[model samples]
Target: MDLLANLVLGFEAALTLQNLGYATLGVVLGTAIGVLPGLGPVPTIAMLLPLTYALPPESAVIMLAGIFYGSQYGGSTTSILVNIPGESSSVVTCLDGHKMARNGQAGLALATAALSSFFAGCVATVLLAAFAPTLASVAFKFGPAEYFSLMVLGLLGAVALAHGSVLHAICMILFGILLGLVGTDITSGGQRFTMGFSELFDGIEFVALAMGLFGLAEVISNAGRQDDRQLVTKKLSGLWPSRADLRRMTAPAVRGTALGSLLGLLPGGGATLSSFAAYALEKKVSKRPRDFGTGVLEGVAAPEAANNAAAQTSFIPMLTLGMPSNAVMALMIGALMLHNIQPGPQVITNNPQLFWGLVASMWIGNVILVVLNLPMIFVWVKMLSIPYRYLFPSIILISCVGVFSVTNDVFGVFLMAAFGAIGYILLRLDCEVAPMLLGFVLGQSLEAYFRRAMLISDGSLWVFVERPLSAAMLILAATIVMTFFIPTLTRKRTEVFREAE
Candidate 1:
């Protein structure tokens, strides 16, 4: 009854004329951006980060969150149509989604992705509404020491869960930490690595960094690709799945949702990790394991569902516990802070409207996305028909313009271009940028907590272990790190960490 009443209230909040308009706008823009290859929500959201200042807080957040999941849907469009994944999590979809396209089932692939995302989003929103308060309550018990240890554990899990050479990922994380330290020292008044620039005092702007690294860099890299190869012009067929297809996909979707929802509760690589985990699980459980990579619908559906669910549910820790496990969530934390809403265990009791309204909006938003996208499939496919040379230049121009608009400072444009160059270089080197961004975002908070914990203990380091929860987290972190080094455990860890890149 309580849930029903809150949901009714949520509907009242969601159905408002202003909120509905924002929801529509968000799904539309999110789909448009997601359809474009080489641009993901990170840079786009980061670029638009400044714009949230102008809108009502709930509306802004709803729109931003819409972009996150709507991209999940849009990503598969590119993956199926062009064999180019619009987002990392969609890479697995490319394996089977493209195969389906080749088999002349592009429309089916798009439909599957859209429907799967809509279903998963609905389930995840329910889970988010029901479980958020309980989780927040548990989070309230965490002190600085526990948070610090939890962060450490999160970092370890991220490394263990990420794809690519573990060594390289670690190097990127360390470099990110260094970049994070470039601003000012939290404990001491003296600056650590700022040469003399006043801009360095506040640390590198996350918007600038993210826009440069992910957005601009992707544009540059894509520009260099062979023009003929960049466009996906395949003719599509089969908009509807057969009964057999439905039977195969249903189980994966449900299983993926369960796995994703659970993983979303933990910090770090939640959505991405859950997607990969779901794929591996699907393969393990399938009777026809030999058909794993032959564009099985189950293969496409499972990870797609998992990634979408995890993406939505990742908000659990962020809204409730004030912990952002990834770069995107970190940005959300920034968004909440901008609104003067301190995210923590107390947030649910204090801001029920914000919490429930957001949840309600998510449900409504996903429905809007699915309704809007079905017809837009024709439009998105036509987008592939545009000449690459014409599109690439426009993208670069728009990216530059977007960056400039955000800061209105020429320096920010230069920073974005510089990072774009760096992003391209790292891409060529096969280095993953996600972890670096995550590390950079988390670095400041980790430092603050570390200092606060120390101050409380009068500079004693043992405070991290003196608390039971903190001690347990530290132990978990230690175990995760040690597992990578042990010969017997290395294989399992490597398999778990291996992701599509």
Candidate 2:
């Protein structure tokens, strides 16, 4: 009954004229951006962070949330038509989706991907709604030590589950922490890494750092890329799936949803991991494994479903425990903080309207995606025709403009450019910037918690070990780091991501 009432309250809030408009606009923009190859939500969201300051907090979050999940739906289109993944999570869809398209079943593939994503999204939203409050309630009991330990676990888990070497990821995390420590000491009012610059006094601008690392860096890398994409088919017919198609997709979609929902709750887990795991699971379970990559509808349905489900459920930790599961969630945490609303369990009790409305908007956004995708499919296909030359310059200009708006100063743009160079350098070194970003995001809080814990315990350092929950989390973090060194586990971990790529 309480759930029903809360849902009713959610719908009522989400149905407001202002919130609905924002939700619609967000889905539209999100789908548009997602259809573009190589431009994922990270850079896009980073570019838009400054712009979000002008909007109401609820509307801003609702729109950003739309972009995150809506991108999952749009990525499949690019993978199916051009055999290019718009987002990393959609890479698996290309295996069967493009094959289906080449076989002149582009329409069927698109319909299957879209419908499967929609179904999975709906299920994930329900799971999010049912489980998030309970998780948040549990999180209400956490203190400084617990919060600090949880963050440690999250950071370690990110590296343990990421797509690169654990050592490199650890280096990036340490580097990010170094970056986070560049300003005046919070406890002591003395400059540390200012290097005689007045701007460094406030520390690195979050907007500039994020925009540089993700937005500018992406542009710099993609600016020289050649576009050799050729569409498999321009004319899409048979937009509806057959009864056989539906039968084949239903089971995989359900299974994918279940797997994705669970994986999405883990630290460093999101659409990419969910989709890969789902594809592997389907291959393992299928009776006709030999036909797995020959344009199977189940293949198209499963990963697409999993990625979207995971996209929705990834919000669990971010909203409830304030732990960012991935780089994107880290940005969302920044967004919430910019709005002056602290991320954590208090978000539920202090801002019921925002919480419920955001959940309701997710379901509505999925409905909007289905409506936009099937009938308006041609619009997205047409977007592919636009050349890279025009897109790159425009992106760079908008990013600079957005960065300038953050501080109303030229220094911010310069800072962004500097970070863009750093981001490029890191990219060349085969280092993932995500762990660095997470470390930067969590560094200050971690330091504050550690200091506060020490202050409470008279600098004994045993408080973390003394608390059962904190000790357990620290042990888990240790276990995660240890697993990567084990021969069997190391090989298995490498294979899982390698299979996806």
Candidate 3:
């Protein structure tokens, strides 16, 4: 009953004409960017963040939230139509979605992706609303030691789930932490790694880093690739799926929604991880697993559902505990801080309107996405025909302008360019950037908490281990780190013996 009352209040706030207008604009832009190859939500949101300064806090947040999830709705379009994933989460979709398009079932693939995403979004919103307050209550019980331990656990989990070698991921994370420390120490009021640069006193600009790493780096890398034009189907046969396709997709979508909702609650788990896990789960459970890569409707439906659901639910930790699960959520924290509104348990009680309005707006945003995506499929397809040579310059210009506008300084532009080169090099080395981003975002908080915990315990190193909750989290973190290395050690030993023989 209380939930119903709160939701009623939320609807009243979100249904206003001005708020609805912002939601519409956000979803439209989100879809457009999501349909463009190599333009993921992190870069899109970072690029548009400067524009949000002109709007009210609630409206700004609502619009940004729409873009974050709406991209999930739009990403599958490129995957199915062009065999290119517009977002990382859509990579798995390309495997079966493109195959379906090649087999002349493009319309069916698009329909399944959109419908499953809509269903998952609706379900995930309900889960977010119900679980957030409970999580916030639990978060209130945490102290500095516990928070530090939790962050350690989160970083470890990110490394464990990150793609490629665990050693590389750890190195990337350490690099990010070092970068994060390049500013004035908050407690001591002394510069640590400024290198005599005044701008370094404020720390690295997150917008510059994000745009450089994701936007310019992507543009440069794609430019170096051989330009093979995308092949899109000319005729999208039927707009709606047949009964047989629906029957095949129904169970998978439901299972995917459940899996995604659960995973989204974990630290460092978001849309990309959820989608990968969903596809893996589907393959494990399917009676005829051999058919998974052969353009099965289940393959298209399950991952789309999982990514969308996970995207929505990933907001839970950010809003409730003020802990960002991914780069997108980290940006949301930055947005909230810009408004002078600290996120956490107090956000719900102190700013009910913002909390409820954001929740209610998600539902409205999802509806808008479905309506826009289905009828405007051809428009998005037409966009794909635009050559990369023409698009790349505009993207570069926009990224530079956005970074400059944030700080009103050309120094930010230079920083972006430097990071772009660094990002390009990292890409060539096959290092995963996601874990590094997470580490950078968490580093400040982790440092603050560790110091506070030490202060409280009078410089005792055992303070973290003495607290039950903190001790448990540290134990979990150590276990995760050990799990990754133990198998590698055994494999290396066996390889050495084989070489000797």
TM-score for each model: 0.90, 0.98, 0.93
Model 2, residue 438: distance off in Å is: 0.6
Pairs with backbone N, CA or C atoms under 3 Å apart (clashes), candidate 2: none
Model 1 superposed RMSD (Cα): 2.8
lDDT of 3 at 84: 83
Give the alpha carbon lDDT tens digit for every residue of 208-269 in model 1: 77777877777777776664534344555677778887887889999898898888767666
Candidate number that wins on TM-score, 1 or 3: 3
Candidate 2 shows a clash count of: 0
Ranking by TM-score: 2, 3, 1
**CA lDDT, candidate 1, residue 1:** 84
The candidate 2 region of ten consecutive residues with least summed lDDT is: 492-501
Give the root-mean-square deviation of each candidate in angstroms.
2.8, 1.2, 4.0
Note the Cα lDDT for every prediction shown.
0.79, 0.90, 0.85
CA lDDT, candidate 2, residue 202: 78
Worst 10 residues of 1 by lDDT: 227-236
TM-score of 3: 0.93
**What ranges in model 2 sit over 4 Å off?**
none
lDDT of 3 by residue, 1-501 (tens): 989999998888899998899989888888877887767788778777667766788898899999888888888999999888887788889989999999999999999999999999999999988988888889889999998998889888777766666788899888888888889998999998899999889899887887788778888888855545476687887879889888889999998999988887777788887888899899999998999888988899999999999999989988987777887887887778667788777888888888899899999999998888888999988887777788789888988988888889999999999989988899889887777777877788889999999999999989999999999999999988788768776465344323222
